[model samples]
Target: MSQYGKLMLDRYPEKMILPESSVIMASDGTVLRRIPLPETGYRIKAGLGEMPQLLIDTFIAVEDRRFYSHKGLDYQGIARALVNNTVRMGVSEGGSSITQQLARGLYLNRGQNLLRKLNEASIALTLEKQLSKDEILQLYLNQIYMGQGQYGVKSAAERYFGITDMKHLEIGQIATLAAIPKGPSIYNPVDNLELSAGRRDLVLRIMQQHKLITTEQMRAAMKGPYIPPVKDKTEIVGASYMDAAIKEAMRQTGLSRKELCAGGYTLVTGMNIEAQRAMERAFSQEEAFPPDGKNQRAEAAMVIMDQRNGEVAALLGGRNPSTGGLNRAVTPSRQPGSALKPIIDYGPALESGKYTPDSLLPDIKTTYGSYSPANLNGVYRGQVSMRVALQQSINAPAVWLLKQVGVSYARGFAVRLGMELAAEDNHLAIALGGLHSGVSPLMMAQAYTVFANGGILNKAYLVRSIRNSQNQVVYSHVAAPQQAISVRTAADMTAMLRQAVSEGTGRRARMDVTVAGKTGTTQLDLPGVPGKANRDLWFVGYTPRWTAAVWMGFDHSDPDNYMTAGSGFAAAMFSKVLSML
Candidate 1:
C-alpha cells in the first residue's frame, strides 16, 4: 500500500489543473481583457475555511454522511446504496465518499463501468493515505463543477447570486449552491429555478435529519426569496490587438491556446489602447479610403511598432475587424510592389561596398531572357543616380541593379531583414515584388526596423512578460538585435526614402515630423483592359519614434474589384493614422 501511494504521488502533476482564465494587461498595468478557457467557464477559488458552516454541513449531510469517519470509502454506505439501487432496478444512488469523488474528478473521467470504478477506488485509497481529510475536502470544494459554466463555489456564488463573500450568503442561497454538484445541468438555478429550489429543500431536510440544522431553521431557509443570476457585462475592447497578443504569447512561451487559457497567467502586452482606438476610428471612416463601387468596399490592414525596441503598439487586421478572422496585417497574400526596392535592391547593393546613393544606373527598358521590366509611366531616364532612381521608384533601374548585384546575394541580404523568400523568388522579378508568396505588413514593419534602428533588426513582439498564477515571472522579453546591414547602408537608405516621401512618389505620406517611406502599387493585367487598374497598394514608412506599414486592396482582385487611387491612397491613410499618434 505504501509503495502504491508513492508511485501515485510521483505521477501526479506539479500543478494539478489549469484555472479559469488568463488576464491580458497593457504595459501600464491596465487590464485589457480576460481570455477564458473554452471547456470551463470561470472559476474563483475559495478555501475550506472560507466556506460557511451551514454550507459545509449541508454538503456533508447530502453528499457523504460518513465523510470524516471513513478512510477513503464507506462500506456501509456502499452496501445501502447497492441495495436501494437494486430495489429501484436502476443505478440512481452514488456510494462514493467525498475523498473518492475528489480522486475521480482529479484523475479519472466520468465513465460508468466496473473497471473505472475499481481504478477510482484505488486512486481514492492512495489519496487518503497521502492527504488529510481537510485537504481532500478543500480540493473537492474548489474543483467541483457548478452550473452555468462555473467551476468552484466562489465563482458559482458570485455568478448566480452576486455574492462575492461566501459567508454573506443567506441560508437558502448556501443550500442552493451545495445542491448543484449532484447534477449541475438538471438543477441549474438560472435555467430551472423550481427544480433547483426543490433540490435545495431536499438538502435542508437532510441537514435537519443529521441534526446539523433545526427544523425551524430548515423551514425558514426553504421559504426564502429566490434570486436570479446576474449577467456578465465585461466588454472586450480591441479584439484585433487581443488576438495578436494571444498568438505572440503562445509563440514566446511555446504553450498551446488551451494551456494559456487555463494557466491563470498575466500577459503584459505592449498594446497602446489610445493608439489602437485611434487606428480603429481612422479605418471606420469610409471617405478616407478610395471610392470603390457601391457593391464592394476596399479592405486594408495596418501595423504600428516602436522602432526602438520592436514593441507592437497598435495593429489593425482589416477595416471591419473580427478576432481570429483573416488577419491581413500578418497574412502575406498580395505583392508588395516597389516596397521591396529599398530592402532587396538598394540596401543590399549599398551593403556590398560597391554601390552608393549617387552610383549611376540605367533606367531604360531592358530584358533578361523573356522577362522585360518597364517604369510605371512607360518613360525612363537613360542613366540616373541610385538616389534619383529610388525616389521616383523606377522599375527598370531596380531590376538592372538586382541583376548587377546577383539575385542569390541580394536575396540572401533580404532574408536577413526578415523577408521569407522561396526558391522560385530567385529572378529579377523579385526586384519588382513578383515573388510566388509576398510579404505581410508585419514582415514589412519588422524589416524596416533595420533602417530605423541603424542597421540592427529588432524583431517585433507583442507580449513583454508573462506571470503565472503564483505571481512568479515565467517568461520575459530580452532584446535580440541582429546586425543585418552596415550603419552607412541604413543611413543612406533612410536618406533616399526620406526624399521619396518628401518630394517623390511617397509625398502623400509626408507629415510634420521627419518621415521616411516608400510607395508601391501592383497593377492588374486583364485581357483588353484599356487603362492601368491597381490590384494592391502599399506604403511602409517610419518616423524617428515609430514605424508603420499600410496595405490597401480587395480581398479578391478582379477587373471590377481593384484599387482606383494607387499607392498614394495608402500613403495618405498612413499620414492620417500618424497624425493621431
Candidate 2:
C-alpha cells in the first residue's frame, strides 16, 4: 500500500471505544445496580458476525438500493434521487449509501453544501477502498445514533426491544429497528407504535420489491405485532445504597465525588440485589407504604448487616427508599426507646459483672428527683427479674436497674458499642431513652451485631471493592472488628431479647426462625394538643445469620398513633424482608 493509503486507512477507527456507564454487581455477578455516567446510557458494541442477516437485508434495502453495485456514490441513483427531490420540491433524498452514512456519521461533517458533500464522498470512497464491505457495514451499524441516548445497534435493540443480542431480531423486529434511522423520534416504536409500524411496513415492501424476502415472508412480517421493549423491571434498587457506597468510598480514599462518578470505575458492593429489591418492595411499594388514606404522615428506615462479616446486605433510608437523599440509616439519630435498653443499658449492665438475667429488680412505680417513670400499660408486675424487665420492656424496672448499675459505666459501654449518646444527659431518664442526642439506625445495627455474632462488633461496610476503568482494584473490603463485650453477656442478652420476640412487646417480630430483638416506642408531647403523642418506633433485632434494625415514624411530628395507625408495621416489614432472604 502507498503512504497516502496508509494515512487514509489510519483515519478509520482501529477499534471502537464506547463511553460506558458504571455497574455495581453482587458477589455472584448479578447486576445489582447501574449508575449512568454523566451523559450516556450503556453502549456495548456488537460485531458483524453477531448481527442477523435479515436485519442487514432490511437496512440495505431501505437505505441504499445500489449498495453492493456502487464504489462509493451511485451516479445513476443520485440522478434518480435528484429527480425525485425535484418532483417533491423539497430537499429529501441524499442518495447516500451505507458507506456514505458511516463516513458522515462517524467522521465527516453533516452539511448540505457542495464542498461538504464532496468531502464526505471522498472520505466514503477512501474508507471503501481501505476496508471490506462487511467491515464498513459493521462500522455503520455500531456508530448510528438511535434516540434516547443509545449509540450502537446492540444498545438500540435493547433500548427499543429489550433484546441484548442483535441476532435475535426477527424480520418484523428488524424492520422496526431499521425504520428508526429514517426519523429517530417519529419512527421509534417506544414513542409512536402505530407510526413506527407504518414505517416498518414500508421497509418490508422495499425488501419484497428487491426480492431480498419472499412475498409470504413479507406478508407474515407485516402481520406480526410490533412489540416494544418491556417496561424497565430492574429488580435491584441502587439509589440509596449507591449513594452510601460513593460517600464511603470518598471517605476511605479521599477522592472527590466528581472523581468517583466521572466514569471508568466499577463499584463492587456487598449488598445482594435480590435482598435490596425485597427490602424496597416491603418499604416503598404501594402495598407496604399504601396511599390508601392511612398514616400518610408516616415514614420508615431499615438496615440489614451480615453478622458474620459485617457486609451490608440491604438498606432502606426512608419510606420512599428508591430516590436517595438525606439517608435516615446513617445520620440524625432519634430516640430508640426500649430498643436502646438491651444494647445500651442491659447489655453493658450484664457485661459489667454486676447484673444477671435472673437477678431480681424492682418493677414498681419508681421516682428519681421529681422524675417518675411509668410502664406502657401503667400496671407493672412488682419485683421482676432483669430478664423479665427487658423481655417485657417495662419502663419503671429499667430505671431501677439503671440506678443500681450506675449511669457512667452503662453510657461508656454503650459508646464502645457504637451508641452516639448525649453529653449532658446525666439524669436517670437515660435508662428510659431520654437522651438529648439519639442513635442512628446504622449505629444501632452495628452495635446489635455484637449480640448476633457472640460479642464481636464489626464495622458495617457497603462497598466490597472499587476498580478503575482499566479493571485495576482501587479498594477492597477488610474486616475491622472489635470485641466490645464478653460472650457470656452477649449470650444472656440474646436470650432476653429472644424472649422479647417470643412473648413480649416485640412479639410482632416473631418469625418462623428464632429471632432475638426488642421494640421501642417513644412518647412525645406536641403543642395545641391535650394528650401525649407517640413517634419513633423501632424493632432492632438479629438472627444467627443476619442483624437488622427497623425504624418507623413521621417525617414531621404528629398526634396520630403510628403503631395503631400502622400496627406492627415496622416488625412486619422486617419480617417481610427476612422471609424473602
Candidate 3:
C-alpha cells in the first residue's frame, strides 16, 4: 500500500460514521423527544440484526448484485455501464457500487465529474480494506439518504410507515424504502406514490431475478396495497418543553442546535411533568384571562423553577404556541412593572443595613431632577411603613427608597440576583419597573430564587446532564449558588411579600400553602380614558419548594389592544397553577 493510502485509512473511521439524532429525557427518565439532525432531519442508527432480511435482500439485489464477489471497484460492472452509456449516447447507468456510494455520501458531494469519482473510488478502496463485508454493508444501510429529510432505513421506516421496527414492515413497504435511495426526491412515497410503487415493483422483480425471493413472493408483494406516508407524531407531547430544553442544552454545551441534534447526546432535563401539565392547563383555560378586546387577544407567559437546585420545572411561553415560535417566557421584551420592586427597591434597601420592614418611608409626592413618580392610586399617605408601602405597591415610596439606597448600588445588587438591568436603568424609574429593556419571566424567576433559597441566588437551568452516544457523561450540572443577600434580609423581604399576597396587591394569589409574592401592573397612557388601562400585568412569587413568575399582556399593546385588568388577574392564574400542583 502507498503511504498516502495508509494515512487515509487511519482517518477514514471517524469520517465514515454517520450522525445519529439526539434524545431528550425528562428528570424521571421518561423519554421526551428526539431532536432531528440539522439539515438531514431525523436519523436513528440500526444494527445489521435490526434490519429485516427482506430489506437487506431487496437492497443488495437492486443496488449491487456482485457485492459478495467484487472488490471496492467493480471493473466488470464499470465496463458494462460504460458500454451501455455509449450505446444509449447518454449517462443512464452508474458504475459505482454500494461502497463507492457510501464513500461519496460520507466524504464527498454528489458531483458527476472525474475528480469527485476518483476521490470516491480511493475512499471506497480504503473502506473495503479497513471494514469487513458486513460492516461495509451495515454502514451503507445506515448512512444512505432515504427521503423526506430522513438519513437511514430506520428513520425512513418510522417516517414513511410509522413503523419503529423493521420487522413490522410489509414486504411492499420494505421494497418501497429500498427503492428510495436511487432517487430520493423522485421515488419519495409521500410525495410521489405512483412513482414509488412503480420503483418498488421493479425492486421486487430484481429480487426475484436474483433468486433472493420466490416468484410467488414477488407477485404478492407487487399486488399489495401501497399506503402513503404518515406524519410522525412522536413529538406531540411536551413540544414546547422539548424546544426549551434543546435551547438550554445548546447554551450549556456551547454547541449549536445543529451540533446538539447530531451529537447523539442524551439530555436529562429538570422538567416536572405534573407542573408542566398544570401550567399548560391553566394557560389553556380561556376564562382565566380577561375578555379579548376588539383588536387583540391577551397573551400570557410563566416560568416555574425548582428552588432546591434552581432547575426550571415548568415553562409556558404563550397559549397555543407553535413548537419553535416566539418564546416570551425567555425573551425579555415586555416591561416587568412593579415586579422589579422586590429585587431592586425593597431587597436592596434591606441589604443596605439602613432600612427595615417597619422603617417609615415618605409616601408623599416626590420629585427628583424632573422625574416625579406617583402612586397608582393618585393618593399617598405620609410616613407609611416599608411593609405597607410594598404591600400596596405604592410607586412613590419605592422610588424614594431607591433614591435612598442609591440607584447604582441597587442596580448592581439586582444584577447579582439575575436581573439584566441596562446602563440606562441606573435611575429612580427602575423602582417602578421602568427600564430601557424589560426582564423575561425566566429572569424574574431566577431573581426571586434568592428569597426562596435563603439569600443564595441559584441560577435557573433546564438540562441537568448530558451523555454521549457511547454512554459517556459529556456534561453535568453543578450547583453554584451565589450569595446575593443576607439571610436576615431575605427573610425580611419574604415577610413583606407574604403580607402583600395575604392582604395587598397580590391577595388574589393567596393559596392554602404558605406563599409569598408581589403584583405589578404597568399603566397605559391613553387620553380621555376613565380609569387606569394597563399594558402589562405581573405576579412574581415563590413557595417553600418552587419559584414562579407570571406575565399577562398582548404582544403589541396599543389603545385598541391593552389590558383592562390589573395584576390580580395574573396572580389569580398563578393561584390556579399552584392549586393544580
Candidate 4:
C-alpha cells in the first residue's frame, strides 16, 4: 500500500454506510412504520436550497460568526477560547467554531482529549475542501442532537413547540434552541426552568455582544417570562403506539427490524386512532382497579375488534398502556372465574341440540359431593329459563344445567370457540369458571369475538399491511373468519349476555350503546384476608363496537391482600370508555 494509504487505513477504521429508506405509511398514506437503523432514528432530509434564509442566518449568527470568511478553522476564535478557558478554569469553556463542532458531532465523539481534537480538525478541514460551506452546515444541522430525544432541528421544533414549518419559530425561540446543544440536560427548558431561562439570557447577551441583536431587543427578550409549555407525557401518544405496533408486527411477522424501521414503506394497521385516543382518555382519567396495596393499581386490558372483519381495533395491555413491565391485555394468564362458565356450560348445551334460550332449568340449591354452590347473594330463585340463568349468572342453576349437559362435552365446545382448556375432570366448578389453564385478555376478547360475529372467529391482528420501498405489499393481515358456532347459538348467547349487562352482576358495565358482558369474583386464595376467598376477580364485556376484559387480584403468593371485586372498578372504566364511543 502507498504510505498515505497505510496512514489513512490505520487512522480511521472502515464502517459500512447504510442509507435510510423512507418510512412506510398506512393505507390512508399516514406514516405508520419504517425499517429500524441507528442512522434512521427520526431523520428527515431536505436540501440546503429548500431551507429558510432566517434559519440559515440563525445558524450563522449562533454557530460561526466568521463562517462566511473562514476556510474551516477559525484560529482567532480558537485562540480566544483558549484564553477564555484559561481565565475561567473550566473544561468546554472555550470556543469551537461551527466547522469544528460539526466535525466532532458527525465524525468523532466529543471527548476532551488531544487525539479526538486532532481528528476533528483534520476532518473539518478535509470536509471544507470537499463540500460547500452551505452543504456542510446543512448536514451538520440534520445530524445534530437537540435535547428531548429529538435528533434534528425539525423534530425538536415539532416536539417542543408543535411547529412544522421551519419559518414558524421566532428569533428568540431559535436562539434558545441554538444555545441548547451546548448542554442539553442542564439547559432543557422543560427540565430546569430557571437554568434554561438563564442560558437563554446568556445567548441573548452573546448576540448583543456580537451586535447581532440590539441592546433594546435583548432587554425586551429578557423581560419575558420563560415559562415552558407542559409536555403531555401521556403514554398513549400517536407516535408512541405506532412505534410499538410496528415493533410487535416485526416480531410476529419475522420481518427484518431494520427494514421495518428505516426502509420507507406504507404500513396499514388495524388501529383506529380516534378510538385509541378516546380509550386512552378514559383509562388515564379514571381509577380502573382497587387502590389497596394488594390490588392498589387498577390494571386493565381492552381489545376492540371489527365485528364484520375480525381485525383488532385497539388493544390496551394495561390501564396505562405505557406501563413497561406487564402487558395483561396481551399476556395476563388468569383464571376467568365465572367468566369461563359461558364456554364450559352454555356452549355445550347450545351444541347438544337440547338447550335453547327459552329452555327452563331447575334453579335449586346444587351440590357435587362436598361442593354446594350458591348464588352471589347466597339465595336462589327456582325454575328459571336458560336466558335468565345466564343473565343473572346464577351459580346453582348453571351448575345444575352443566351437570345435566356434561363437562367433557362442554370442554369440547369451548375448544371450538378457541379456548385451549387444559384436560381436567370437568365437575360442578366448570359451571362456575373453574379451569385447569388460564387465558389471556386477548384470548378472551377473541373468544368473545366469535359470538359478536355470529359464530365467525377471525384471527386477531394488529397490523393491516406492510409495503416496501417500492410500494409493493410485503405483508398483510387478510381477514378470514372461521365458523365456530351456529348463528342461532351465537345470537342466543349475545342476547343472554346483553341481559347480563342490563340486570346481572355486570350491570355496572351498562353503556348507552348495546352491550353484553359478565362479571366474576373468586375467593381470595389467602386464608385470613378474605376467609377462604379465591385469587381472581374479573369483568369481561363487549359492546356492539368493542370488547374488553378487566382482571384484579394480588399476584403475591401469600395472597393475604385486599381484593377488588372486578364489577365496580373494571366496569366503571368500561362504561366510561363506551360512553365516549
Q: Whose TM-score is greatest here?
A: 3
Candidate 4 ranges with C-alpha deviation above 4 Å: 1-50, 57-100, 122-136, 147-149, 167-247, 252-306, 309-322, 351-354, 359-385, 394-418, 421-431, 462-478, 525-532, 557-559, 562-573
Per-residue alpha-carbon lDDT of model 2 for 210-279, expressed as tens digits? 8878899999999998666667566547577778888898887788765666554688888877777788
Candidate 4, position 102, lDDT: 71
Q: Please list the C-alpha lDDT of all candidates, in the order they appear.
A: 0.85, 0.77, 0.85, 0.68
How would you encode candidate 3's per-residue C-alpha lDDT over 1-581 as one tens digit per residue?
22444466576656665788998888888777777676647778888898888888788888887887887788887899889988988766769898888877887888876667777788788878878989999989988898888888998898888788888888788889989998999897887988998999998888888887789989999999876556545334466667888888887888988778887789999888888878888888999997677788899999999876899998888887767988889998888889889999999899999999999999899789989888776897887999999988888888989998898889888988987688888778888998798888999999998998889988888899999877898889998988878999999999999999998989899898988999888887877654578889999999888899999999988778888888889999889998888
Per-residue lDDT, model 1, residue 270, is 91
Question: Using TM-score as the measure, what is the rank order of every candidate, best first?
Answer: 3, 1, 2, 4
Work out the TM-score per prediction: 0.78, 0.71, 0.81, 0.69
Q: Which candidate, 1 or 4, has the higher lDDT?
A: 1
- Give the higher-lDDT candidate: 1 or 2: 1
* Model 2 lowest lDDT segment of ten: 558-567
Instruction: TM-score winner between 1 and 2, please give it.
Output: 1
Give residue 433's error in model 1 in angstroms.
Answer: 1.7
Cα displacement (Å) at residue 366, model 1: 2.6
Candidate order by lDDT, decreasing, is: 3, 1, 2, 4
